[model samples]
Target chain A: MPHLIVEYSSNLEGFPEAHALDALNATIIASGQVQYEQDLKSRTIRTEQFVIGNDPTALRGFVHAELRLLAGRTPEVKRDLSERIAAVLRELTPHPEGMLVQLSVDIVDMDRAAYYKGTL
Target chain B: MPHLIVEYSSNLEGFPEAHALDALNATIIASGQVQYEQDLKSRTIRTEQFVIGNDPTALRGFVHAELRLLAGRTPEVKRDLSERIAAVLRELTPHPEGMLVQLSVDIVDMDRAAYYKGTL
Candidate 1:
């Protein structure tokens, strides 16, 4: 199971959050990476209070994503997944006029033994 | 820079998101871990859409946290930080009484060389 969390600045007006999630889930499912539809739980968060670097008045914005997966996939598969994710991220590049847009994606793998999934 | 993200289920009502961040920041600063006050960027996201395991109607909830840091601190330091974080997480123990509360913390260190800090 992989968890994807996308955090973006509030000023970004053109970022299609819901559409991007749909595309990502579709892409991941197409890759045959996950077995079930609900295996991937993704969410987005709007970062209203944040300080980017040292500039207090830089008029900057960022959309950063983190995907955590249980250790099993090869490095190449992860790279491919991240590349696809970055492609989706690029769709919102230069979202707001006259603002610096920072887009980044990180793919992380948790140890299979340490990662635990349980039901109530 | 270390980014802290706390994701909790909507069912958990007693988790004071703002308060927990304040305490975490204070604890990290009190430990003399970071040089600047703004070095830490944290945000909370309420998971309104999520599926826990295979249970569709379990009345379950989870409070998961991720702390991402640059690679410089020793394992002992990271362990200490996680322990302190877990302690803070425990403050809201049995948060809403009956529902199962899954609490977890993950301390991840990124390669210092790969980490970049920039301004617009």
Candidate 2:
């Protein structure tokens, strides 16, 4: 399984609102790209806001997302997940003509990183 | 400075093609967001591909990008850099309506991570 981390940055806001998060979760589950009942049952996803641009006048803000998906590393699978997540973000946040928004994905090697262990 | 890592995934290929990487680097230098002469000059950005979806019949392929930007922890800067990078990517890789591409940025805390040095 591949632990996929999707982070998005754009000059927008008002995310994780109402059923947005739920919608994302549902989409992931329905896609069957992940094991909603097992591997992805307790996965964590976070969204935050940030600013960019040289001159403050250039661009305004950006919304970022971090999604952790547990799965094996396969070129094809990674591509699919990346597209699905991007499609969802585009739908969620519509940008203006000149405005800019970006999405980045990180496929983490779970074995290399240590997961949290509950205290004894 | 913020070490910004931008990762992009999409159903596309032929990236880092010829002067593409050079163009990206030049744009970053002109942006003035990073001290290209110093703090921003020596940085790394990597791009890769991955696949997603289950049906294998529904949707396929994705191009991913990972960029490292170094700057202070500021919201505005992150947003601008994200948009600029995305704009560049969009221009570079024109995707089809159905094809999905994603970009995720990770602002790494340089102090917490160690930089490699030539040791005896």
Candidate 3:
């Protein structure tokens, strides 16, 4: 299963949550690397308070994404997926006035031997 | 670096964010499995909208914690840490009225060669 979690600043406006999920899901499906679409899970978390860099007085915005997948993909596939995700975020997230905006995507290789899955 | 991300339902009340963080950090430090305190990062994310299981008619609460660290720890250490985290969650999270509450902890081994880290 590949789980994508997006954490963004609550101050950011015009966030298209549904479109972003579809973009990510489509990217993953187009890659043809994952096992199945049913295993994909994506969601966004809006953070109310956060700090960026060393600035304490100024407000900043960020959209940081984390992708967790069962280990076995080549570096090229991971890189491509990450680039696609970053592109989606860049397209969806609007630039704030007088604020620094940063977008980052990280791919974490989940250990198959250690991961446990069960249905509730 | 070891990062701990806690995602809980926003509908849940009486959440002790600071105390929970301190408890988790202390548990990790007490285990003495990680390198140093500087390498640890912990934060909570309150999700507003979420669905659990097949029940769309009822509200449910969940506390899911994820710990990411450099690969090298034994299974015993991971299990111990997970148990400690679950204990923290169980003790801290209040059971909502007539709602199902579930707690889960997962330890993800971050691939050293694949994980990219940089200062913002």
- lDDT at A47, model 1: 78
lDDT of 1 by residue, A19-75 (tens): 888887877777777778788888887776544434355566777777778877776
Candidate 2 lDDT, B29-109, residue by residue in tens: 576766532222112223344447656665544433344542254777667665666666667764656755554444443
Clashing pairs for predicted structure model 3, backbone only: none
Docking quality tier of candidate 1?
A: incorrect
> What docking grade applies to model 3?
incorrect
Proportion of native contacts present in model 3: 0.07
> Per-residue CA lDDT of candidate 3, range A8-99, in tens?
89878877776777677777767776665545556788888887889788868999989888788889989998998898899988787987
TM-score of chain A of each: 0.87, 0.61, 0.90
Ranking by TM-score: 3, 1, 2
- Using TM-score, give the best candidate's number: 3
Q: Rate the local accuracy (lDDT) of all candidates.
A: 0.72, 0.44, 0.77
Q: With candidate 2 superimposed using the best TM-score fit, by how many Å does residue A64's alpha carbon deviate from the native?
A: 3.6
Return whichever of 1 and 2 wins on DockQ: 1
Worst 10 residues of 3 chain A by lDDT: A111-120
